[model samples]
Target: MSLERTAVRQRAEAVLRRLAGDQARLREDQWRAIEALVIDRRRVLCVQRTGWGKSAVYFVATALLRERDAAAQRDAAAQRDAAGPAGPTVIVSPLLALMRNQVDAAARAGIRARTINSANLDEWDEITAEIHAGTVDVLLISPERLNNPDFRDGVLPKLAATTGLLVVDEAHCVSDWGHDFRPDYRRLRTFLGKLPERTPVLATTATANARVTQDVAEQLGTEPAAPAAPRPDVLVLRGSLDRESLRLGVLDLPSPAHRLGWLADHLDRLPGSGIIYTLTVAAATETAEFLRSRGWAVAAYTGQAEDADRRAAEQDLLDNKIKALVATSALGMGFDKPDLGFVVHLGAPPSPIAYYQQVGRAGRAVEHAEVLLLPGAEDAAIWRYFASLAFPPEEQVRAVLAVLRTDRPLSTQALEPLVDLRRARLELMLKVLDVDGAVRRVRGGWLATGEPWLYDGARLRRVAAARATEQQAMIEYAATAGCRMRYLRECLDDAEAVDCGRCDRCAEALFTPEVSPTALTVAQTFLGRPGVQIAPKKLWPTGLESVGVPLKGRIAPTEQALPGRAVGRLSDLGWGGRLRGLVGEGTPDGEVPDEVAAAVIEVLKAWAHGDDRWPSRPAGVVAVDSRSHPMLVGSLAERIATVGRLPLLGRVSSAGSAGADGPRGNSAQRVRTLHGTLTVPESLAGALAGLAGPVLLVDDLVDSGWTMTMAARELRRAGAQAVLPLALALAA
Candidate 1:
């Protein structure tokens, strides 16, 4: 293709103006990216800061590409065979919020944009048709969509053959070394390989350091036929990682209560509406509730939230109707707000890259936005919890491969019992395996590809080591006594790591570290109040029969346990630290601590007297014998029976290791393990037979709830009217 420089420049300016208003103009870097795509037909990796107009490069390129294609269609004499209108620019976006914003932004440039994501499954066929008809100029899809069986097998080949441009938003996720690496994004390798040879590809991210940038660029430059081939020429445009509008700081707080109090005391003083990031969903919910009680309008946003609620919460934040959205990382990638006022972290994110990506959400369009981190002792624990979910061991992966039949597929649920991984982890592993050629996902489920797959233990270890280093970097970032912005920029390998003189350290402290007594008291009380209900399992896990457990379908109401109560979740902001100390992974078993006993008593008192109290008072207390923490469970049951003036019924007996404490793989395997392990002893049966009211079945913790379920069933058969399960903690 031949083009006049002045004409291309003029066309790009027009598109940019259309996309970003009349006063908008493209930066030289953005223009360079556009030229690379539209004129040079090159693959570009753009590592730019947030709000740096990376999207403008793509939007302008799309407009220019499509317009040139249209001009070619009009001028048949220009070529012997005229190519029809170009295929829609296919964008594999990472987030729904991002896709929505992109669609809206594309429309402003008079580009017909459509998205096919989980939120709009019904419109996928229509969108596909539009793409085929060349009516849609831009099509955005989640990365996961690239691997969808139907889409991959039916529509992807044609789309790849004709796509004019391929844009990968948040391309950092494509690198395992990146802070937020996702396995699904790895599927882009296949998609990139299948793309038309001349198709221009653009990968953009704001959080990538030099390492991640190179990795993503290499992935983009790889030839379809030979991934091992040397990296081809790729246009890499990496700008300064500095966000001029952000003023960063860190405040050392004594506890979660003090941090929440500080937020309640000073949220309004920061800036306009922004976000409060929490480490866990439970913390987000609790923090939002506490803020609401203090008269600040806030809503909790998490991945577990319903689609409608998340949309409403997002809109509330975007419209500035709410003071802030209390959220987890679920709100990270695609959210865009120009004038966000502040971003406060209840706890530090595990890595500086992740921290920068999130805090980048603020101070985009504004002159100044507050970015504060309140580091907690529990942050490391939360990080460890997440780190535990990394790729499974070699043995586990081999077991999964062994179970797969080359001729048939097995659904994840069907495979859960056969493997020792949870549903989410299993699915993620399968996706990674599929990318490695060990397995393939088809219509029914996943099938072994009959290809030799080497376990990349060395690479996995390298990634894990990188994660640990990032975590250490985060710790140093929190404690650093120097320029905060410069520190962050350096972490991203940005050459422009000069002191901003705007942060609390570089300048005078802009925020007071003090928490008002009234706010502190309120936070303490709110967090102190505890009692999380444990809803009983209604139906047995599917494929239980295959696991050698006959149980299937719904649990008969007569044999089912009533909804129970836990003092609090191990992830709870208030009691989590204490509970974790008592029962977390390597903690030694001991008798109940006085504080925990008191907390359990308080939970019982609340359950007995509060609104929606148990239907009836328990007639007796029965302990679920714990092999891991027998003293704790026994003491707790004895104390509760004594305090409530009820009989201490005999404990449920465990026949073998199946009844041992801790997680037992997926639900089916857990159920199978506990199916016959829990039995009502003769003494417990006699006591249950004499009970006139519900019996409180106490345990140290409730994870899968299968042990409790089987124990309850045994008690019900022994003639207890109802079994009310209680636990010291509920695992998240």
Candidate 2:
């Protein structure tokens, strides 16, 4: 071994001694692996799980490389010759947060290191300059950013020329079998091949099964080092899914207000930190405001929220200023809070993988944690909707392909017409295509550089096959009869398959059957009447007047009078009222014309009645009694109960629907229209009045039954008594 390698080994051994204490010194297999990589100069891939000490492998290897460089300088000095600058090591990470953490750790260890990300451009520039100058020893960057040509041509080539080690952290990203795969990762194969042959490469991750391990090897074009011996003593809890500390219940209500009430009750009862995962920003915002009205400290996080707002909300969560957080998928990744006691899914996650990842955030410290998966008819509808989006029409693909095929570079604006997509949406699709190398951006526009033949032949077939596989995985997750964790493990391969007894099915099977009667009934109803379609308006008591209650004269206000009147009524009735303005219109000052407001409320309360028929209006209806209204308090719970048991409904399209010009899945548009109709804003009341047809009302959540109730009444007044409501989840 070289003198420098020997010195590095000595230092590493000392560090290991300190860490291991009286435990046996490094195992023979470990020693052999280390020596081969450091002294003999070989690449290494350490496939291990969390707490496996994979960090030691690279830490020791870097120490040796540093020592070797030092010894070389000393030898050059003795010979009165100038020594070349030492090569700098590069570490490509998957998450910016992880990279920053590593940088902090290295600094504490007295090692020279720096990180590069969108957050620190000036620092990134300085670090790149230092790497070129041969002064920096370690550089950390996200794999996504490494795909940038400017970084590749300007910074990486210099480091590669020097033949420095390249380490890929969270290396599982290289595998399609892994849960997270960035198309940018595929580009690493070509980039790594460009590096000097002798330069060693090291890949590390906390989790990897056999399939993922093999894929990582293929992506790096190298054989993996012998894995460290399994640490059997490490506790791997495959306990029952029952979290005794968590009180579990499901509700079956027909309105969003009821869902909100359930949330408020939970907040009142628990009064601790929790997370509410919604399917959309509008839902998150509405839920947060509802909770706030109930005097709970709450905040919301979603893609639509400004970055500053998201940061503040996260900070509030960390600081415990807010007892609960309402969010979408945007809040899950990179969030760290050890004391979080609960994770409630207001809607079912898009896939089992997403569900697992979100739930994994809880109980990370092995302390008692709880998770709730709330499902509703609308939630199922949302899932079906997403499935439809995933399985886009072949025509859409053709249109996108045609845009990409333009010989000249085309800007998003120019391409939008061809693809029939808004500029923003077109950009998202283009990004996915770019990551797949199906298109390339040049100058101010995009160019169609993808293989044309591949577009139609075997390559396209392969892409389709992959999508089909993903679809199958989703279906299996939704319909599986066995353990959810095991299913996830089978699908992801990288995740451990051990049963987590905490999931609903597992807990029910192993511990107790806490299934709700309402949910079971709804599920049975759906199963029995698979072909039956009922309109939301028809479900309300007003539509059933022929059966029992009297159908009386109802005046429909003009659309122009709706907003002010609805806002006034809700505010007067103490329903946490706020009129989301259009353009710059302010809230109109006046009691909603009494007849219109009272009529809307009467219809809403009648529909919300738990009894089968509408109650006598003047006597049975209570004016927004926040305390006694089951529709407001138990809305989410009731919806959850009813929807959880319902089987998945097939996809439905919203084409030709009035006011449906926005993005297919925009929550804002859905909420605005649904709420506008529910509140009977004169502007919308007229449109709804005397309208008759089978209509489908889609929303993210059926929280309190109020929104759906009012919507049904408006539809009835409009002459359309058949209105079906579809939502992603019924908040529980």
Candidate 3:
């Protein structure tokens, strides 16, 4: 080997030792990746499990490149052109938690790492200036920022042109086949295309199958713009996906309450502090509250969780101060607690790949960690709700493009009237379109590129179909009589799929299938104690007037519905689970069941008779006529009136309602559909004539809340004192 090669090897060894103590040894795969980046200047894709030292490969590679660049610059009299900033390593990480963890980890190795993300917007200018001055060695950014107007057009191109080593952490997001595909990650292609030749890119992911692996590898190189540095062969290094420390199990509980009861009873018996994964934000909060009620030190976490709280919760877990963090997917990737001792899933993830990624979070550094899945009956329903948020149809895409087809750009807020998508979905669709070159995010907002964009319907449908298949695979994994770990491995397309004697199936099921009666009673009481406050809509949706509606700005307080209550939320893990079966999507509309009516009585009685009594006793009960669930709404109102000893006011007619499904539409269309839907009957007007207090406006369920809003307005117009919406459940 050349003397220079010898020196690099020595430096790389020294760097790894500092990062992971002197006892550390570079595995064959790690050495191959580093050698490729440092010597061959080739791009590499490393597919390995969590705790497999994937970060080490990039950090070490960055160290070698930065050192060489510094040396060449110091010998500037001989090679002055090589003396510039050495192009800081640009890392595209997906999550804030992951970036924070990585930045902290990098600091241990004497690496000066900084991040540019939403959480640190105030610090970005300083960080950016440091980068330009070559004082920052590593810069981490979220994928979404790649398409930010100023960042993309002004900042990224310069960074791309100069980035010495580009790392795509969580690289599976670049492939549709991966469980966590993010459209923003697709912008990597544009970034890759802009990079000069031989930049030595590294893409690392802990969750990806063979097909996803191939796709990510192809993306590791660049576009054919630089013929002088044509893309070299991608160095693919894959390690076994199996983690021996994980002892997997699946316990099939009869109901959501029973599952909670089990957790309440058994959480303390677990080995160490870890995560309790939930499928939704509501579930996370519900589970955390239940566990806390049982005297467990736990905190709820979700994507909506405040950043400071999230950091505190993370610290608490690391310090083993909290028993567990009941969290959504927000806590999964890039969380680096090596001694985490358990992971329990309250509901199954839709894809086996996603399941693996989450469970992989446990047993990473310990000799043993228990992983259990108490699959919910409502997992499929949650999966479908998420699936509905998939990429919009071809027509919606074209509409967005048409609106931005002028020289003048328009912000997403401005485009709301022109297009028919909710803000979140619209922004996401724009990101995908932006990546496809259909539109551009700029100083004002977005602009049309006039570039012909193909919708790729087949690709989307295939992804959807793949999701369905994976959901079934997860279902099978839960019910499989064979090995649990083996089934998961096979789903991930891992080459090592043989059964281990460690899982529930192989060990004759470790967890008991029963919850103690006392625990169940506590859980049931906690869940059944209901009264979910429905916050009244305060502001009229913007652009409603432009869309030919007369309303705009803050909603008239008188027109808004009074804060109301439902027995439970459909996303709740307790009574909410039962409610899900009743009013769930596709479940035929019907009258409220006798048992459910009893629960409603309890909720109403609590509102009127408990410490937090209703503002005023409802004078009477009124029904909102339902085109879909007339029997359910009518029966609900009649039962409440009969039980409360109040007169039954006549129902409001649904005759004024109008709209097509506008399938997969925005909130504006929902509001428009119910704008004039409620009209008071003369009988109802007469009934309200002598009413002295609020009227209970009963409906089968509340979703989007427009129906309730309009009904309340009609009742107020007809002289009702106040309208309180009561329902069996609220769709999250």
Candidate 4:
């Protein structure tokens, strides 16, 4: 109880030792940040490179701050009241993996840390009680939790009033202009303003350009709306954003199969266990499967993986029990394994800033690590697909605002058909609006604030332009002949950008270009042996009745199309690349390629004998009229009919002008777009009027599947016994 300032410093040093053993000592920047937060109570923004001990600053500062508080209270002769809080540190992190790692690390430092996230819903009440009882020393939470109705209105105020330190990990997400911006992070302003005077706030990020740094700094100084509080002057500590340990390189493979072949042969030669990052979940899955088939110990990780599975995979990787985790961006941020020796990107991310953040995960505590980019020709198409899902257009935002009423809460399900955005995008827009005070997500869903919100068109355009610039920068990085590491640093606006002499471009090529013939054959076989089941839609999308469709609840068994087949997915690692050139978002419609035809034949051959085979072979083949891919669909139908020895029935034609153009929309909107657009041709109707066997319905692809659904229904209504749908690819 009589502890002095010097005593607190010694205790901090001891805590650090406990976490990292005798080798633990704070870096100058870490000590500076800790002293500023604990002594000066000033807001600090640390924009250093990854593996720079950013987490250590917060954990050490938390220990010092709490001890400092208790010592002052004791000296003042103020006994702790029953209701007085333990003055815990609240850390708003970006991912569950981050939270898990932080919580475990904190316990090692003798600092009690707990987390409340989607993964621990069953323990929310228990965690809440612990917080109220002043038992938690540090609380880690996801950004999304800050906007929850019960959390925002009921729990946050108490937590803020008692919080001694606020740490914003991955704080670049606070700025709209940041590469990985999230609107939920902007809600931190409200939380910050509610804190007691002079509460220390620390924000840290590994990826931020000069523009993003300034933007986040400004937001760090923003106060909440009412009874304005004084903003704390932020102390910015930006170090050289370079990893001396990384040896960067670019490997431009000619084709997807070759890339997989390269990985199959070379994965064993890469330094140590690290992450193999892919741009999509399907790619991660397919890559992991290929690697496993080739005798590599690996596991696939994505946002779709269960929480327990992710935890197990993370542990396995940490223990060096596996070769690597084939993962998407899901396994990113706060996954700490000091000896992680390499990071290989299957496809380039959209920006050099993102690439820097990802590759930095390697060589944290080692002298050397390998960072390689296997950029694909299809990278641009994948980029464009994700760009489509960015912040909605201004009109779409206004439309969402128009539907929310002050008196009622409408769940996302209830709002889908009423708006054009899909559920994910719709929910994202709502969170952005919620942070802007234009709407609020409540128990059931969301409600309007009746506030006059400006469109900020100019700002949105600036962000859009910035994205395009970043994308071009990434492409340039992939092709640049200069220092690969330096080019990335320059893109991040690092003031200390210099040639990393360790890179392939800086020295001689570090990796060989040749892939073994056996490896290539194996990769091709895995890629070509393709068949993906097109799961049939069962329940109708809610609010379809409001869209003038008069449909809701279960889709009648007869109305639904039977399970179908596709050659592959647009996001698959192997067939995906070739399929993209033929059926990607902007690719012009064309006849099926000979290669694709052969693959389709293989699919048919397998279907005729595979377990999911149809009850009987089709008696006839029919084409679904496609406004975009008519030739492709017609040719596919003719080829299938000829090969299967079935009659070529006439194609179904569009009877109405209605069509859902552009990339796919929400389910209800897609269904509405094609509900009455298709009609059975008189010739096709007559041919199918007495058909007794299933009809093979051919199309270029199935995106929303509404086209196939509608076509199949029309065929059934025309008297076909059953419909069998087949296509070249399933849009990811």
User: RMSD, each candidate, Å?
Assistant: 1.8, 14.9, 2.2, 2.7
Given candidate 3, what's the lDDT at residue 258? Answer: 92
Which stretches of candidate 1 lie above 4 Å from their native place? 1-3, 79-85, 224-231
Q: Model 1: per-residue lDDT, tens digit, 1-732?
A: 345877899989998888898999889999889988887778899999999988888999999999988887677775444332278899998889899999999999989999888888899889889888889999998888888899889988898888889999999999999998888899888887876556788999999998999899889976853445444579999899878788888999999999999999998798999999999999999999999999999999999999789999999999989999999999998799998999999999999999999998998889999999999999999999899888999999999999996577899988887888889789889989988888999998999988989999999999999999999999999889999899999999998789988998889988878999999999999999879999998998888887678888999999999999998889999989989988887789888988888988899888989887999999999998888888889999999999999999889899877556576588888887788788888988887786789999999888888888888998998899999999988987
lDDT of 4 by residue, 155-218 (tens): 8888889887899999989998887899999989888887777778899999999999998888
Sort order, TM-score high to low: 1, 3, 4, 2
Evaluate model 4: give its TM-score.
Answer: 0.95
Tens-place lDDT digits, model 2, residues 1-732: 678657656776765554444452664445555665565555566754333345455555665676667677678663353222257667877655456456655654456777777777778777877777767677777766655657766766566566456777767677655555555666566456556545567777544555567678766663222234221111111112222333222334444444555565555444358788887665676678666765788898887777667778877886889888898877754465656767777656655556655665554444566665554435544554444433234466556777667667776654543444434445555655665667775665677775542334454455446545655565566556676556655555544456566555566632222334553443333222111112222122122232233332342332111110111111110121121111011222232333333333333343436353322211110011111122322232233223333212111112223222223422222333333323333533344343433333433223333344454445445444344443322321
Q: In candidate 4, where is summed lDDT lowest over 10 consecutive residues?
A: 77-86
Worst lDDT window (10 residues) for model 3?
656-665
Candidate 1 local accuracy as lDDT?
0.89
Q: Candidate 1, 44: how far from true, in Å?
A: 0.2
Ranking by lDDT: 1, 4, 3, 2
Q: List the residue pairs that clash in candidate 1.
A: none
The whole-model C-alpha lDDT of candidate 3 against the native structure comes to 0.84
Per-residue lDDT for 367 in model 3?
96
